[model samples]
Target: MGKIESLDFIELGNHPEKLVASSKQDLYTLCYPSEKMPVPSHYADFVRNDTVMLNNFRSFVAHRPFHWAWFLRLLKIRGLDESFLEVPGELSYSLQNPCIVAIPHFGLHMLVPHVLGHFIRQDSMVLATGNEEGEGVQDSIEKILPNDRTRFLKLPDRWILRKLMRGYQSSHYPVIYPDVTSSGDKRFRHLSFLETSIRVPLGVENLSRLCKCPVLPVAMTYHDDCYRLHLGPTLVYKEEGSIIFPLFSWIEELVHLYPDQWFGWNFLHEMIGEAKLLR
Candidate 1:
């Protein structure tokens, strides 16, 4: 949250419209129904270069085989202690002071869904994703939601999610994507700027202030033999703006640690441009 050295987004070389069109075409074909098309050229490149970084740990977390063992290992980290692992039990009691668990986005396409399934299965919990979950995403949620235990709810947009969170305490378990932006760089869609306001997604910070919840930084990365999930020290904001800088610093560290994991690289560049304009 300290003064960030500004980056110039406008200086980025303009990508040709034809290249953008081709990338989009390939991506669409890959996601289209009926035919499970070939992996998009762009994503194939990503997998080629970065899949090695994921290694076997990605497979384990992706499939979710030995989760208990994984959790136990995370608990053994010094200073993480008991209560950190106790959040599952804690959720049923008081969500007045909820926890903001920020996990990295690398294997997170898998990790987030797994974490949601894990909580709902064990605790009769209900979790929400995206602004408004589409039918497809909801179908994915249904496959995971337990019959006798947990309830699955989808809020397709932020407005509805906010309203539901206020009304239903169980809705407190929210999987938020704070980084949302339209990048002029079409190559990276669904990405957001990282540095516009020291910490972008100021809304999330505001929510933490209002909820008085502690922010827990979660990271899952390929390490040594397995994928490691590292939970950093808990963060709490004091009454007078004490938490923003620390929270911002924490996010910056996360960005540096897992730069490729962040889907918002292009968005961050856009925010850099906005920051310069305002100055």
Candidate 2:
């Protein structure tokens, strides 16, 4: 026999799902009176609703379609260079190989990886949701933004994430989603955001520890018909054991600065119980 066989590594991530139906329409998922969020005094005059409950419910439904349509349009255009404007214009130097680019699932979240991967010319793999709902979103995104050195994988279970760590160990770039919530994982580090405690995935910290690499915390926003990305300082390993502290602080600042573009606004209150008080 004069034949040679080669094996390719299996990709564990999946593409992002298409924008799903509004969770607001699901009666069982609706917020209870006691659980409804509150409206801060500052925005009382601007918001038409008396409470954050009514306001959030309305905003959730209203924003759903637009976010989806925006994704669709971005896919159609496929203009990574013109679509995004990164802050600190000198961001290129800091984005080295073997780095973890952890971005918040803020407004224009998907675009974060797309633009970064294309611009930086790095091998990219975004962690996917893996479930039926998540697959739908992925289907929508991949239809437009596929095969540009940027790819998606199924949700990072312990095994899959470890594989990513192995590849990252050898200098492959894995764009991470630090804000995506999964079902009942105790490893998450709970931190306060917008005055409410939100659980953050320990992926960034764990990966950095495993590979001994720093993380690039990126925040993205959509405004005036364009996407803007702000690259914060890199998070190096520290004696404190949690790199998420500084990253969360920077995220809070972004959420505070652009309330509308924070993207998590739709279900954040539901996710965090203490979110009863709005910002």
Candidate 3:
């Protein structure tokens, strides 16, 4: 982790350039594990293009402090309002129904559930891992959101799926990050993403079937000095046996448009191993 001079919102907002520069070395190390090691095949294109890669790294670096400051601000505020987000008018109506909100690991992703709770005006459950980082995010959510508005469920529990099913049955929308890498999970599919294939979990698809609800793809990105939440059309199980491909496909498009806003770029190597060409 790089040192951030201050966590103040205004300070972070004003020193974006400094923030990016300060973390340049650390970001390089994260992207390139070893000087002798070649870039991962899936992320080779981004690395090959110096300008795009630098922008992506800059976004990766600056997003953290900005997100932390935003989180701190949220803790002090009463709650969020429609003015805080830029949602499409038509999509506003779609949020009325309880559906699986499949969000990718993008900019300010940790804030998606809280933002959705504002729009849906209902309680929702967010699925998170039980790791240190996951617990930290869970703690942040607990502190920022009213206890009644949202619930955080850690992953890998046997009854987790049942819990999600019941939550959906009770009209509690389940928020999931579909782009996470699943280890030793047989229920996954490989789909083309960027320059390589990525293994996407079938959990979201299964949950959608069990709950008989559609999967709504959501992305929260930082653009033009504002945090915008973009929503995609509902993906119903009736249309396909699996929505993993289409769901990730939409995320792929967003990543291309906002490569710097995507946090997944940092873990691209773990998601899909170094390309054979690079090896």
Candidate 4:
């Protein structure tokens, strides 16, 4: 297996008790702040209280095993089936026409390729940041998924960028997570997220402009014993300015709708620290 720098890999087959313990500790460290920040008036409804926060934390912990199980299935260690995924028919067009697919770091995000593989006929690339914590699951994904079908490229590699440009020209779908705290290029914009400003990378918009491809906002959620992939309207690039705001606005809606499934909530405070607050 090839290694990408600063990319940590998750050790599979951990004891259930250990997983729970680690997850609880991580939840406490990241999600529970020592000092609670003031919630903006409009953002109050989206804020999670102690009980809801605990529930969300529990949901986050519970999903890890399922993610590992899905990875096992992908690696052929366990039997795999399509019944576990629910994809919308609307995704057919996007799959057919190569576009930049922007997905949030939501529930079971690494399983995206496996779930969409059944529908995607052309090769696709999944762009991930090398610096983000808890992104070790990506290493498992790279090892399991065949490179020819879906290539996992950690950003900041000039060679990969060249390949991505060529791939887009050839109709290969490039999937990216735009809501990350940091990007490979270190380019970011502090935009309004849940009524508070947090750093969002400009990679997605930059790539879309460079490739001249429309951005397809996709959201993945886990519920009812399956994963659901929802496709939003395609966003075309504008010559005048940045699309990061509108793009993230759509993401905020999804995060609000499925707060428990969103992994961002864990480190959200850190992302928002000292950044400009939205009025």
For model 3 the TM-score comes to 0.75
As for TM-score, the candidate ahead, 3 or 4, is: 3
lDDT of 1: 0.38
**What is the TM-score of each predicted model, taking all chains together?**
0.47, 0.67, 0.75, 0.70
Model 3 over residues 158-230: C-alpha lDDT tens digits? 6666777888887778877788733224577777888677766787888888888899998888754466788
Q: How high is the CA lDDT of each candidate model?
A: 0.38, 0.56, 0.63, 0.58
- Where's the lowest-lDDT run of ten residues in candidate 1? 4-13
Residues 1-279 of candidate 4 have per-residue lDDT tens digits of 311111123443222223323432332333323133333322324553455554554645554554445434433432245466566777776777677877777776656654555456645544333433334555555444434255555644655546666778876777777776344546677777776778766777878889988888887777645667877778888862356878888777887687766766555655676443321
Best by TM-score: 3
User: What C-alpha RMSD separates each model from the true structure?
Assistant: 15.6, 10.7, 6.9, 7.4
lDDT of 2 by residue, 1-279 (tens): 211111100111121232122222332222234334444433333344556544653453344345444444444454544543545575667664557887886766755665566545344344333444554555555654456445555553546567667667655677666666553335777787766677766766877787788888877665534556788778987644467888888877776676545556545654464443454
Summed over model 2, clashes come to 13
State residue 177's C-alpha deviation in candidate 3, in Å. 0.7
lDDT of 4: 0.58
lDDT of 4 at 188: 71
Question: Which candidate achieves the best lDDT against the true structure?
Answer: 3
**Candidate 2: worst-modelled 10 consecutive residues by lDDT:** 3-12
